[model samples]
Target: MPSDAYRDIASLPPALRFLAGGGEATKLILERDWSDHPLGPPEAWPDILKTTLSTVFNSPESMILAWGDQAQTFFFNETYFPLLGPRLGWAMGAPFQVVWADAWQQAKPIVEDAFAGRSRHFIDLPWKLDTDRGKADTWFSFSYSRVLSPAGDVAGLFIFTNETTERVLADAALRESQEQLRLVNATLEAQVAERTADRNRLWQMSTDLMLIAAFDGTIEAVNPAWMLTLGWTEQALIGKPLFSLIHPDDLSHTIDGADEIAAGQNFARFENRYRHADSSYRDIAWTAGPGDGKIIAVGRDVTEEKIAAEALAAAEDQLRQAQKMEAVGQLTGGLAHDFNNLLTGMMGNLELLQLRIARGRLDDAERFVIAAQAAGRRAAALTQRLLAFSRRQTLDPRATDINCLIFGMEDLLRRTVGPTTDIDVISGAGLWVAMIDATQFESAILNLCINARDAMPHGGRITIETANKWLDDRAARERDLAPGQYLSICVTDTGTGMTPETISRAFEPFFTTKPIGQGTGLGLSMIYGFARQSNGQVQIHSELGHGTTICLYLPRYAGDALMPEEEEAIATAEAASGETILVVDDEATIRHLIDEVLEEQGYTVIGAGDGAAALKVMQSGARIDLLITDVGLPGGMNGRQVADAARMLQPGLRILFITGYAENAAVGNGNLEPGMELLTKPFTMFGLTAKVAEMMKYVGG
Candidate 1:
């Protein structure tokens, strides 16, 4: 069936034996068609071609042997597959001119010289190979020597490809010893010939980082670009282990990659870090493969690309945080506006009921009054939390003694939490005074205490401690703050602590660990916002099974502490004669409550439904003693717009603007003229009356 079935391959010359046993080469050499071959069947090849093929194939180097007068391929080894890929389909018995037509122009003269008995050596000769993936750029260092017949006439040629520096140089050195006159008269003479000058020029001029390494990991040669990129000379790179120049972190992986290349795997886009001469590292992406028992590698630097990718990630995180804050502010601000209106109506009516009971108009109303007061207080607490979470709360800051403030809350905290837990207060000696809104600071402390209490449903200790902290540059960097003095207030609780993931999001608005309905989830978020607004920081430390601690660091105020104001007793004096008060509100209950209270105080009272209605009455020349209006009212005007319009009619009107979120979100940062004051909603009846009396006093003067 085939010549191989009848002949033992080992009995043949080494070149014929190699082709007979090669996986694909054997099938191509003995099995493919050669009926039209100019040199006839492969068995009929000339003796010079047969021996030259054996010599080229037996060596562990890439080679192609072209035989006969017509230049037909007699043999090629497995290592030549990439250069001949798809071309191998017709390469078996085809003429070199037909199979390599795409590159025949550059190869024609080189082959002609070898057959003419002129030996030649070419380095880094460039060419292209057309395969399934299209034209590919390639280079080679090869030598062509004449193969002579027994009668001394030139019959064919052998091309020895120099894939790596060590193999090609070693071969060149060996040929110099035995191949004296034969190479002198053959293609070996081309090393000093004019035809090779262009190829040698190309070798020294390439800008790509190209290198050759032995299978055992010794570098053999490198191009000029390697020196430019890594600051290592070619002579320095040639004698060192290839992995020595690699980063320590990448050495083991690079060693493994070299093994893959040694096993004949072609690689592309393989990346690793390489060490530079300056003791830094450069990121490189490599393309490598095995060739002639060695490895050829090409690398491209990718340091800037990696840096750009990291920058993009950080920018994305900032955009996400900004978007999240914008969304949360819109939601919390709306809730505060609606809830404040409801609480004002409920608390105002409750106060009127209490007054009626005092006058004996109703009996058996004490229990109802107590329960309603507690519920109203709870509702007011929730409204404040929403306002703080939205960062729309108006704050009035004053320097205060932190130790005195903590001591004042002791009795109230004990009453609120019952006797289930013990309260401990530890104040620092000579602590720095903090700049904060005194009233809002108390609320922030109370919110933190309530959260700590919930974390420990069973009996536990709640410790409130204060200290003076002077943060240095390193500590300030960790907290993203400027180095300065701060007043530290810490609350510690013997409670179930939070996990790392839970702690990370603990300050996000509406994020809670407690069950639904048990918490509104705004306690920590409000505390966070308040601390930030005071030019301070808030931090939490916890573990899953241990206890938890939360710290608030407020800026140390340089000014002197203001003395706490003494509370004034409610006045029993009646309003002055002929003083008329104008009350405007959308809610009928709140409007009626104010009208009734002022009327009982012996003052004339008029009321309206909205800002538009209020302005109508003020324009009618009613000689109103004062104008009191809700900030968010129905009709085409808000409180601020209505105030602007009314001030034009009566330039010196005594206006008291009532707000929930309006002071921060609606009126913005603008100055008010004289004889104007602001009062937040959900105020006690006494507080509203006191403000009215104070304003009337100012009007009379």
Candidate 2:
């Protein structure tokens, strides 16, 4: 019936035959009744109009054409769909004045110039239109050109438009951001000036070998300690190349440390041998930092201490080896008992599932399948907990309101702590937003409450409070954190407290005080690692009688936070035609599984087992829409190296990093660039598909 509506399309003149393949626009043009239009029937249309229509229909950019002496009639292509609103239903072959009535006044002069044979271009031309969502403001950058007949007479107008509303708004936002950055720079300059004065006051009083050197390692000045300790007068040390006095073997490390400081990283503590006035090598421990275009350094002569340290280290190594063996044996027993139990559930169900399939017992297989899946999920969770303890787990950080997140978890917290533990929540007012992984934060809080409950062993009170804090230099140093604005979530318990020894070892992995069979000893350690990985700190306050309080301190996020209602609207990914993906993994099972999943979702997948093989595929110049790679790879190259090389070849390639843990210093330590995303191992098929869909939204945009 639909084909019958356009049955006469085949009878059109050869000049109009170009309209045959322009998708929905072509179908509408062919089926429309052109008899009453001023342009008349397609058979009578001019060759210029026909050819121009063909071009308009095939163009990938938004285009509209107006023909006839008065430029009354109009036509557009599929690319112009977005510009159409409620008028789209009657847009095809509609009068130009009726279709764009809202913008006609603003467009009239440009349209007239085009009809008079002069082309015009406009940028950020503003307009207002009534749409399904009511009135909306829009901006467009476009060009209007005249279409002429063979006689060279001005005939019609052709317009190409690109919406500039988003760009216009973004430009305004960027100006605001730049102003804010200028203010921040001013504040930093003042802070630096103040710090410099403090350092100047300490320069003469300090009893260390303090010196100022040029970036190129030329010593400029030295304090009195340098002359007293190294037998070199201040005049002798000054004007000398600092590195020339170092032992040959220490040159490379010293140079590397200098290079790092030049590249803007704070110089780490360093040690090297420096020659004394008598040509004897002195083992000097050094600390250095960049200061006002020079390197400010302090060296402590550690020759005596170094010898004592070497002897102590040798003895400590043997003690550590014996302790490690004992700890490993205990760890093995605990892990073996738990893992074996979990494996039994999984393997037993899988075996039963196979037996049922062989006996054709389809109905009985569902239970076994579910049981096996449950066991597998538990094992995956256990593995994640272990990785969390080492801060090696992948984290998906988002800007979040800590108060809102905790409010949402109130019900779960109460239910988790049980009826005996009275829960109290005190959310901080005017709390600054934080960037964190919400799921892991919730898990950490839950673990703290569980530990508190176990401490009481009876009815107790758990108070959770939040507050904004500014940690100055002294406070920050005590917490082993940098000075800054931080928000803290503190949990306190009215229960039996920990001894100083217990408190000190609380965050050590597998060092729990609970009975061996009752605890895995990873809970507190996981929380500690998670906090550190998130650029935050966790502190414990407890004594033998007083209640214990544990607080997690996270740095404040400066940017606008994405609230619940502001989540990105990402459409489910259904692969477009010819979308190809390349999957690289060392494990055959993982590679095949990814290949099958993507293939089922209508994607063409290419598989490679190692980084070298994947690079070869990239070099082959095949079209790759997405690359899914495991971070840990064999054959001398890892996933990050492959991705970096692939980006060089194809800068816009989207990457999905799949990993068991943060293994290759793990995906830039969770700082993935734009167009890149990460997925942890043991992910469900649904999670894999969903993440892929979310990332695909950035493709070609």
Candidate 3:
């Protein structure tokens, strides 16, 4: 079919061999065929195939041709001429095992597997070759596959090979770069995880209620504190509208905050109310801002804080009222003291005129003196009322049963409130006894009833109750009172109540909610001062459109009760004895009044306008049996200074100090010394005479 059958085999891709004449140097026919030719001497063929393969593959120029089942060597390429040196041409027809005994040891397995139809590959296979130049060491990647004949029978090994030194070095470099990248990625992942854990811990451990809400006011996330504080589970709050949990009064404000965030505005220090799990509203202060495409808000409950602020405001108002009352007391005390001195002078003059007229010297003058005395008595009563409001009125403390006190005054209270109002008295059988002035107590009850009557234009019930209460330390601390037993007398009326603002200023003098002239605001102020002076307290509770309750708390008598004294014996009486009296005062009217009163009492009176003049009189060696001086004097000398100078001159001098403004009056630094006496000025002649005689007796003692 062709020139030769071997030409068909040689025409394949791999190199092929043919025996020539005697087989010295072999012809390695690549891409050709010579099997149909007769056997000729090997020296007749040129070694061009081995030379060409070596040059193309850049390998050492040496080649071996082995064939048949015994793998006998038959030819050598001319490129292997110098490798054998002296035996080069004789090696061409030698058996492969004899020619390459050492190489066969390594190549045998590769050749056997390939011949059995298995492909074999090797990297960095080390080999040596001798050339005309020198012996050379090299590495190669070798692949071996079985060459098959046209009949599909194994023919020979076909080896494909390439040098691999540069590729092996580049492989080491690539592996190092991949390892470094892996380490870098690992480090970055660890850092990311650490930051995530830190953020999670911060979110969980916070005490403030934290929430993440969407732009539409839907709650997207909430911290544990939020759930715990609201008493809600995670699922209950997630995806719900945030305003649903807010108080009704606060929902609009909260929604506005969301609108602000969506508009790219931040809200700071927004305050509103939220509904608690217990169904009460809590004052909440929040700060909300946009964060990571969501609105993050933190809030704190401030309900107790708000209540405390309201209580503080109420207490401040009460303190202001108390201070106002104290100012009024100071004014009243000053006026009453000065007024009593003038009344004493008038009464003494009236007494002198009456004595003269009683002798039947002039009937008309006697009638005038009697009429003047009647007018003086009325003026004294008015002074007493002012003194009571000032808390300077003389008090007669007694252990009076509160139930009996209320019962005794029920008829008067009924008359005071009028026929429209019904009076009800609720008295506890085991009520505690209070030590208070009975006259002031009656006045206080009358004043409260009048107030209650004014509050109700229509008919209403008036309830008076008495109870025994033990005020513990905690209650006392809140009320600013001492811990002790108390007798409480509560007066309540079903009348129109006052607003908080009105109630706050209720006890302030001259502050009235009533139409002008319908009420005098002094009623409650007087009651407050009297109660406080009697070691008691007054509490008022009222609400708009609701009724009012006024409670009086008086200290209970804890020790053995004392017997009440006769009231008549304690009243002031005219003195009988007459003595020389020295009267010193800064006010000219006061000086003249004292001098007239003492002279009318049958005592020789010496008057000085001030303490310095009184001192001169004493230094002049006047026989002054008594020194009566106003506490506030001009010329840098007060009553006490004049008395000290006078007493130095006359060791047995009787002294009386009078005062109107006692708070500013010069007196003892702490307490009055024994035998030293003081008399508030707005007194009657009888009271003045009694005080003068009493001091003289102390001089006698």
Candidate 4:
């Protein structure tokens, strides 16, 4: 072997210290023929190269030192034997480009960077190597660093490398095995994580209070939401009895409900108050169910909601009260203004009569008297309309056929509306009987016809229709009426209709679209009040250019209708027999007038100013045939009390009540006792006599 000749180090030249005693690799280096080599002989080598060569030859790790331009010259130690295989002998002193000729394409850039004074490392770099067996796939890890000359210029590259094929292949096999195991477990683990993550997120982040409580009301676990909602930490709530936090007033009921839940029952909703951290109570609405020896409860904070609901109810009540007050104010103002005008006319005419009679112009007195009487009548009519709007007017309800009533009023309605408007009456066949006041109904129909006539400046059609209506729940709600059979009397007009604003306030008192002096504004409102007082409803449907329909829905009377009574001519009525009557009124003028009227009818009339004066007269045991009293009196006891006292004194006494406006309770809600009747104030002398005559007849019969 060529290495046997280099055994004697003393025989070698002095400059050959780099080829000193190493192993077989150093002997082989000394025996190499380098006369024609690019680096020449070791004796002619640079000191840095020789020093680096000695280090490379003696080192244990696989290392290579490449010198010169392009790092073409190479020197390696015996460690290369395992990596380079049979190529080691020639590859030791060869240029790296030639030694790794097959891998030069991948190695060239690294060599260039080292020459440019840059260093880089690669781990598990892959390569294809030709071997005795065939092409082999291999891996290597190496670091390439620049080596500088003494002049500080990059002259070569120093590399450290190791063959890592076995370790790299072993790691790949282990990773492949691990990936197969992971794929096998992915489905079940993903499902479990999905469910657990969702539950944990809901428990930790939800706003609603969530907890698990034992069957005995002990809290086992609580979500973080307990801290956020009620200012109690999860740790504070856990192991605490749930009933301990409940309000004292709500504790018993809450315990009962919890007991129910623990007994395998579900409570859809349960409300209770819980003590907050600040010592105030919060309302909690809980939904709970029993689950496997525990109770799962979800509670929602409803304190603010409850407060808002109560506030809304209070606000609604306040609004209704405010509306009522406003209506009262409007009604009072209207009545005062209109009554003052009527009073001026009446007083002026009476004053004129007084002046004429004093001046001995007796003939002129009758006209003034007539004028004052007319004004008085007008005032009475105004009071009646106002009473209708207030829904306190006296009603004489009877079961009457609505179709016959409309037919009977057809001619009168046509004459009242004048010649311009056309009247069309479409009365329904088999119309149901309505329990309504026929006189008031006729007046309501007349008022509607007059309004329809006024609506149309030019000629238009007025339709009066009667029908049987069966209002369902939804329909009844729209009309503000209860669901039942109703007799509908509708008056429709083709005229200049009302706007939305006008229609909305059509039934409000003193709310009219007519010119100020021309309308009292009580027409529709009067009809509305009258209908409601009769247990009925009225609705107005109108549009700007279309037309208007005013409907009256009167509840159907189940009984058979009776023929209306014939009105008697009471122009010259007088008392049929001698009768003693008592008249009680706070107003002296009214009391004196009633006394004169009764006296003129050939009856003894007794007068008193107050209820006490009347009761005193009744207590005197005088023979009183009848009692006529004003409902309102100045004394502490009203006329009704006087009547009661008089009845006790004379059990068979006939009583007559009179009032400026109908006081429903004062007049027995228009349900006078037998042998009793009512007469509204401002009654004519003729009417007063007629009522007395009829009562006298009842007594005589």
The top-ranked prediction according to TM-score is: 4
What is the Cα-based TM-score of model 2? Answer: 0.55
lDDT of 2 by residue, 1-701 (tens): 34333324574456567675467787778779888888887778877888898889878889998886674688998888777877776789998888888878977888888777678888998889776546777789999998888998767788898888778866754564454344324565663464356455665567678877777898876777776777888788778999999899999998888887666444345789988888899898877766555676788888989889999999999999998898678657756766898899999999999998999988878899999999889788777777787677888888988899889888988898889999999999999999998889999999998898888887799999999999987689999999999999999999889999999889876778898677878789889988988899999999766679999999999986776766645335544445788999999999999889878887799999999899899999998889999999999888888899899989989999998877736478678888888889899998898888777767788
Kindly report which residue pairs in candidate 2 clash with one another: none
Off by over 4 Å in 2: 1-310, 316-333, 514-518, 544-546, 568-578, 664-666
Candidates' lDDT values, in order?
A: 0.75, 0.82, 0.67, 0.82
Please say which candidate is ahead in lDDT: 1 or 3. Answer: 1
Counting clashing residue pairs in each candidate, in order, gives 8, 0, 10, 0
Worst 10 residues of 2 by lDDT: 176-185
True-vs-predicted CA distance for residue 430, candidate 2, Å: 2.2
Provide the lDDT at 13 for model 2. Answer: 54
Give a tens-digit lDDT track for model 4, residues 1-701: 35544445665677776666456677667768899898888799888888887787778898888887754687777776677765665776788888888888988888888777678989999998864335678899999998788999776788999989889966865564454344324585763464356567876778999877877889876778788778999779878999899999998898888888776666678899999999999999998876655677899999999999999999999999999999999888988988898899899999998888888999768888888888889888888888888887777676788888888888998899889999999988889988888888999999999999999889799999999998877689999999999989899999989998988888888877888899988999899989999889999999877789999999999998876553343223444576989999988998898888778778999999998889889999899988999888886887788898999998878888888777788767777788888887778988888888877765534
Comparing 1 and 4 by lDDT, which wins? 4
TM-score of each: 0.47, 0.55, 0.42, 0.66
Task: Flag regions of model 3 displaced more than 4 Å.
Answer: 1-415, 418-442, 458-463, 466-468, 533-535, 543-546, 556-563, 572-574, 612-627, 637-657, 664-681, 686-701
Ranking by lDDT: 4, 2, 1, 3
Per-residue error at 462 for model 4, in Å? 1.2
TM-score of 4: 0.66
The TM-score obtained by model 1 is 0.47
> How far off is residue 546 in model 2, in Å?
4.2
